[model samples]
Target: MTAPDSSAPLGVFDSGVGGLTVVRALRELLPDESIIYLGDTARVPYGSKSPDTIRRFSVEDTQFLVGHGVKAVIVACNTATAHALPLLQSTFRVPVIGVLEPGVEATLSDPNCERVGIIGTAGTIRSSAYQYALAMRKPGLQIHAIPTPLLVPFVEEGWTDHPALESVLHEYLTPLLDKGVDTLVLGCTHYPLLVPLLKKMLGDQLRLVDSASTCAAHVKTLLEAQNLLRLPGEKPTLDIYLTDLAEQAEALAKRFLGSTFNKVKKATL
Candidate 1:
């Protein structure tokens, strides 16, 4: 197939509104580009689902975006990317980018990050995607990944600074801290929302790798190299779809996009 038109909108998907964090980064780095984001709100927590189910939902999300003539796809959900990125790349024509590799790359890019740590949902940590990716980049790399499953729901409830949140974070991060990890990878896109609190609890001295920003940077580089970047000064468009609860997704999108969405509608898979 011919290379996608420079004006084609880039596609992005997540199990839910958490993916908007990625869209936030993309807009910052590539302000002229159009974007279509799909949130599978009906299946919000892909982290707990089986790999087969996650893969199925991911394909449906990708196909839905492809139907909208997206030039490339971003698997913004760490769990979905961990389970289905390979299949999506092999089956799709456009570039398929996942949040995982970019985060790993960002973590290793820092020279002071010798003992790297990662925190994610149960499924993401169980997949060992970050560990494997880090090892591939640096054999014998000291890595620690812990599943802080509670953090997701906490963020959804807007409970960032609650006493309970601090307790849970300490419980989840103490082991990695003890292991002398100097850097932490926010493996789940949703985790970035808790950064200020995380830094407060873990101390400013610890470096944090935000996968969403790194993934967006990677997308910018790819678009530039392929000459697929949209021209500057164009008023970029954003169309968002959610499998369920469009209102909820719309409400949450404001937090991620830093503004109200221009178009938000309910759509299936």
Candidate 2:
């Protein structure tokens, strides 16, 4: 395989538009680096799928990104990262980064973080990727992980501030709060959109570790270490691709990506 050029765009993929949150973060941190994001919207919500299915889908997603000549690939979906990151790293020539490690590193970066609570999809929580990683790095650390499956749909529906969402948040987070967790990791990329509501409900004490932002920072570090950072003075561009473009894709993209939302093209894989 030829070496990835510094001028090549970084590739990022998720089960759906949620990965745009990562793109938003990347745009802010590495303004000169162009990005190619693919959303496997046709197979949205890989969380409930079997591990084998998730791995297959993730490989196809990475293949699509690699075909586009991306410098690196970011598995932005927590479920995919949990199940397929190892396979992707071994299979791909370009750097493969997952959202899990960065979030784990950020959570442990807090010296006072003894008890940590993680909320993600069923697949992510069931796989215990975050839980295992945390325990491995900080032995004896108290870790509580729950799968808040409904939260993803609510976020994608743009119901972030809906009254019903408050009830769901309480249902999901009350147990974690009761455990007296000092930190909470937003394991899913889509969860960041709920941060405002989360802060409003949980208030100032709970330290929220956002996977999207931390993953973006990690990507920047990796690119720099490998001398793949894009040169300055070149205007960066973002290209979005979706396997299935729903009618609300544009609105959802805007919701997750804010001002950085770009027109999405259809992806075959």
Instruction: Measure candidate 1: CA RMSD.
Output: 1.3
What TM-score do all the candidates reach, one by one?
A: 0.96, 0.97
lDDT of 2 by residue, 1-269 (tens): 58999999999999998999999999989999999999999998898899999999999999999999999999999999999999999999999999999999999887989999999888899999999999999999999999898998899888999999999999999999999999999999999999999999988879999999999999999999999999987688899999998998878898899884557799997
- Runs off by more than 4 Å, candidate 2: none
Q: Model 1, 197: alpha-carbon shift in Å?
A: 1.2
Q: For each candidate, what is the lDDT? A: 0.89, 0.93
Q: What ranges in model 1 sit over 4 Å off?
A: none
* Model 2 error, position 179 (Å): 0.9
* Residue 51 miss distance in model 1 (angstroms): 1.2
